[model samples]
Target chain A: MDERSLPDANLPPFEGGRSLLLGGAAAGAAGLLLTLIGGFIAPKAALYSYLIAFDYWLGLSLGALALVMAHNVAGARWNVVIRRLGETIAAAVPLFIVLFVPLLLGARYVWIWIDPPQELAKETLRLLQYKKPYLNFNFFLARAVIYFVVWSALALLLRAWSVRQDESGEALLTRRQRKLSAPGLVLLILTATFASFDWLMSLQPAWFSTIFGLYVFTGGFVGSLALLCLIVTGLRSGDSALGKIISADHQHNLGKLLLAFVCFWAYMAFSQYMLIWAGNLPDEVTWIVARSRGVWRPVGILILLGHFLVPFFLLLSRDLKRSRQGLAAVAAWMLVIHYIDLYWIVMPASSLDGLGLHWTHLTAFIGVGGASVAAAVFLLRGVRPLPVRDPYLEDSLRYVQP
Target chain B: MKRYVLGEFGEPEDCVEALRKLHEAGVQGLDAYSPYPLHGSDEALELPRSKVPLVALTGGVFGALGGYVMQAWMNGVDFAINVGNRPPHGFWTNIPITFESGVLLSVLSIFFSAIFYFFALPRPYHPVFESEQFRTASLDAFWVSIETEEEEPVADLEEKLRSTGARRVHTVVESA
Candidate 1:
């Protein structure tokens, strides 16, 4: 509430800290341009990659929300410094609301299961029918509403508790938060897992991952922590209190969480893919076959190296964990790879045509992801950027693993 | 009321002031409390060691055995079904649930063992609750005590308590 790297309430709003605004604008322009370019020439591969881009962006937003919930549940005090950074991403939930318009508009092209009941393969149809109670257009729309409701509810509640603590230094609120966290964790897992089933898992219709929900969860957590480290560092440079408020120990701790998520994301992704490949069932392997080949294979290799190996090695040094610059470099790398990983997951589905560039996808990317932030920024305006009042803040501030 | 007041230490060459005093005075069976967990509280107090971890480990093993038995009994005998060529106990499939059950059991047993280990059954040694010294532990204070249940009367313990640098010595009486 008092000290910030950007603008504080007493000070005017941080005018130029809106790369997101420009980013959103750029995405809109790109999407519109691609929409026009692809209008006359509908290339299959390009269409597929464009669709995958949607998953990539949405994954970023959803993953951010999941991380916020996990931190709240685990009572991780050191993470309090980056709680708002996570919140900014969670607050972008509304952008997704706008983003989904294109997906909903283009559902048939994206989801084969959305095609008529008689036309789909028998197993696919059976699965589709079984899931119809949940996967039909009406239910899908309803579920989308529900998903956002749960997500936005968590974002609002956690952010509210944090900012409230800024005003009142009562330690009891921290205790109250611990009590609330267990249930919040449950709600987060339930919503995130099933929402995966609704959104991406339904793409193939037949494929399932008991841990697929966790895959999304892990990606979100890693991506947010990277975004978090970068944002917090940016905030800390000039903000005097922030410099003191966040310490080497906190950085080390957050870096460790980042490392853990990076590993978990690798583990879950590998295990899920391995299990499906090992089973070699047509239903399961169908999902992996595309990514394991050609242009997608290089991206796959890049993901293995960039997402897991690079971070794993770079973060190995103890000094890197504690240093701001070292950790920020790793984060920037993580965000870029995360985009690729998201791209890898969705592009394979639309392989019939070449991975053509669409102005709409780029437009939708900004329109969807951009508008999400603009809405969040407007709502988050005047809101306290730090949870100054958390009882655990002091505990977290002085915390060193004893 | 017998009270113990702990005071400043002697030189680095000297033994722990409180323990040296208590041993010299033959103060048998006193309880100690501190604001924070002191490094050598047990050794200074000369209390018998706790075997709670051993009890906890035994309880954990028992819990894991129970989880396995319960699953085997349920899947193998109770309501078994053959799925493909897989065995009824396909414990791999049951790994997640079994592990969860075992963990749940271990935690529960630890809770119960702690109650048994810390407090004896009949609860005969109840001390009167009112004491400023006890409250000081919540803030900034450290003290130790020997019970008044020996050949030595409560008066002897009280006298030794003051020389040990105790801020105050209070005799906690039995309930009337």
Candidate 2:
């Protein structure tokens, strides 16, 4: 709207990614091979660890997808500069469809309900039977397929339209994106909720909480926001194109949202615990009881401090959020805590006694994480770093927090 | 008696530019008024950071502590009701009320501090109201006003404001 030249939309695509892609692929292969060996030696433990790692990466990618859809629907201008990065992360959902196969092959090892133990009481068996209508393997597989299809469709369509706009520069593309995203957000939340239930909650078929989906979704969203901060700061330097576009104002805003979601995740976690603790039902209370009593208790406490309190206080500073290194440090810390959070959720059922620090956990995490990073970098190199032709790109570049 | 020299600008940008020039020239007691917030005005005015957040945090911390203690005293020690054989003081149950009171107190503190301390509002009249054209400060025009407690030469300041693009300038004297 002002008499200033806008950044050229015809800018060159991002370069210098082949080494990162190859390195990431190498790490991923090594981790996956080691995890494959763990499958033969300690099949159940390897499967559970792989599940934890799988959930961490999957949730983060979905979180990115959720944010991009929300940005489109709300027409937020502050995020327009870094919208491509989020789109790239979200666009990596198809990769998870391939990664989900290991879980499919080893479902019984991870989920007790898949092959209920013979030592179980008759009443417990009856309960499993009652849940079979919803939790059966066939329905579970169908639902997983539906969830991935829905997620990939939403993510890919949004990215395709956005990329097309780079050359077409049509206002219609923006309108079309908003149109799909408005409904896409609802579809995403529903699918994500069901996905959380199927993959994580089914680990303990007897336990149920209405708020579990929201809890998982919030944590994943927080992780993705942290990842977004790291990606922007990692890619940008004083002389880079992103550095010219993204200012400290943008980082400050991202930090504030990260802080807010950290609180929300805490709230969701606590709210679920409080209600279950109050209800004191035999079925529901057992889940919380198992988590609070054993080695998992200390892990929960760590999440309280590391995931919530420490970052909550650290990110409160106006200066740290604006600084590149400071914000990136906090982001990396949160990503680690997010993995631990998932580990705490999924590992309790598998390892009854201790924190269950296993080599496979590390290997499986590296495998999934390395592959995800490689996919993201590969996707990033294919497009312009930012949505250069977005109608609101200038607003984001000039954005100053009020 | 103090004099308030008011200048009107057709554009908020010109008004902000004039404010910066006046500030650089060491002219004190300068402020701007507009129907909407003008970007860069805070920098031009060199305003100090607001302390409302600190006040809010203090209130919230105290409120949360008070809430927790009130529950602990009333339920755990004072009456010590036995409900369903649960613990007399349930820490988990106390959290929701703790969070609510914290938020409630934070909002109350921010509202009161902003109204009475930061803004000093509820006054009905000011010397700026004497100029009918100044009413546009709230509707359309941008205004820069300088308030001096002691008499200062008015003509040079008026010339500076006009030179910087103030379309109309006038001085109002407050009767004391």
Candidate 3:
């Protein structure tokens, strides 16, 4: 249980991180350049693809922030080993603020109300007029700035305090973090909820689901957990001391959590659909109608199977949950399905009739994802992979599944 | 009549280690008792993995299928009530109940199977209970009990238990 017992190599600025940062940056540069070029060719599709990619990466960062805050607020010890990973991901929020510029510039293209087309239905035009107070471009930009500012402050403060604790080993720092996280979680969830309303829900301005925010949040959180699984398993494959401390028991717990959240995301998705289905109202049913048409129908079914059913059953086995390879594979699959889930959400608004598959989708994903990875690794540089000075670090390391 | 040799250890680890050693020694009919579940006790005792999950899965799948069929028959075929011009057997409406039934059956199977089959509850008596000091198995003590027939050698088993760090070793006979 002693900190001295662990190998000194657990301290960061390692060889793997350097290569990871460089690789991520190079991929980011290439992807962004490609996305830019693709934008000029098919401006509308490119904008939508860029939005999907942007939302996917931003959700991950915000979800990581939420997880770290939840861990601190709840005094969870099992995840203390992976706390820094969450912090590193959360630290990418500032980078996302810069990434938001492209989406902001093309907001009109992605959102219908920003500049409603002349052929928009009379009913929809009236609805947009009524929603004008909340859906205007300037207000939308302002809200985006506020969201990033709040997220940046929360993520940076938590990371700074945690890193300071590594050097000073201040127990007060832990209590201070718990206190900050208590209010921080509430604020974060509220802003995130409203942000989902602004970015995703507004895509279908005529339609609204009260649970859309929760649905988005749940999907993102599940994705973040999947990312954690991959990173933990990936690190174990290497010689990182951080990976050495994590036992299969920890992975099993994480797998259990991933399953739980997967179900939660499904539940939220179903709840939204069921309510709208039962009401059979024009405002609500139109959203579902748009999605169920053409190739989108198959995409919806794919989401159901890939996102929930597959992961649920796979993670149920004790053997799979305990094995690094099994859990990591499911995690990776979940990440792919998560992108599809986002694409399904954002792309439907772009092209209601078809899949609207674009080359920019892949490029924008690489652009955002690679840059996010680079930023996370950069923040992680020179920092201990785990909170070595944490009082509960030993408890986490020695945790046995009961 | 069958005789049982029971070893009581002060520590769970020692008890589990003794179980492992006894298993390695090729001793049969082994079980461990403690106030709380001990980690690695399953492996130490070399017990096969529990089949409750299998039972639960079977129960859940059947339950879900039955739930969907019940709804389909009642709404779509049997009663055939028309509501709101939607499909008579609404897939969306059927889902919640299907899920609930699956969970319900899974829980029922797990609970019943565990009590009636796995734990073999309601018998009320075990040979290990013949030793008055063995009562601590459910309190503060960790116990490993080995069941044997009347013809097997008991003295060597008692000796083995004492050598394996058992604080209070006792032999008990079933009264028929």
Q: What is the TM-score of chain A alone in each candidate?
A: 0.83, 0.96, 0.96
Candidate 2 residue-wise lDDT, A1-402, digit = tens = 123454543457788678989988899889988998999999888998899988899889999999998989998988988899899999989999999999999988888898899898898889999999998899999999999999999999999999888877898999999999999999999999899999999888888898999999999999999998887777554467676667778888889989999999999999999998877889898788878886889888999999999999899888889889999999999999999899888888785448777799999999998898899888888678777788988788768788
A203-277, model 3: which lDDT tens digit per residue? 989888889999998899999999988988887777677777777888888888899999999999999999889
Residue pairs in candidate 2 whose N, alpha carbon or C atoms collide under 3 angstroms: none
Which CAPRI quality tier does the interface of model 1 achieve? incorrect
Q: List per-prediction Cα lDDT, in the order shown.
A: 0.64, 0.88, 0.88
Q: DockQ of all candidates, in order?
A: 0.03, 0.43, 0.42
Q: Write one digit per residue (lDDT tens) for candidate 1, span A175-233.
A: 66566667767877788788777777776677777888888767866887787777666
**Maximum-DockQ candidate:** 2
What is the fnat score of candidate 1? 0.00
- Cα lDDT tens digits, model 2, B45-157, are 89887688799889999989988999999999999988888898999999999989988998899999888888887777888888888899999999999888766568788
- Which regions of candidate 2 fall more than 4 Å away from where they truly are? A1-10, A236-238
lDDT of 3: 0.88
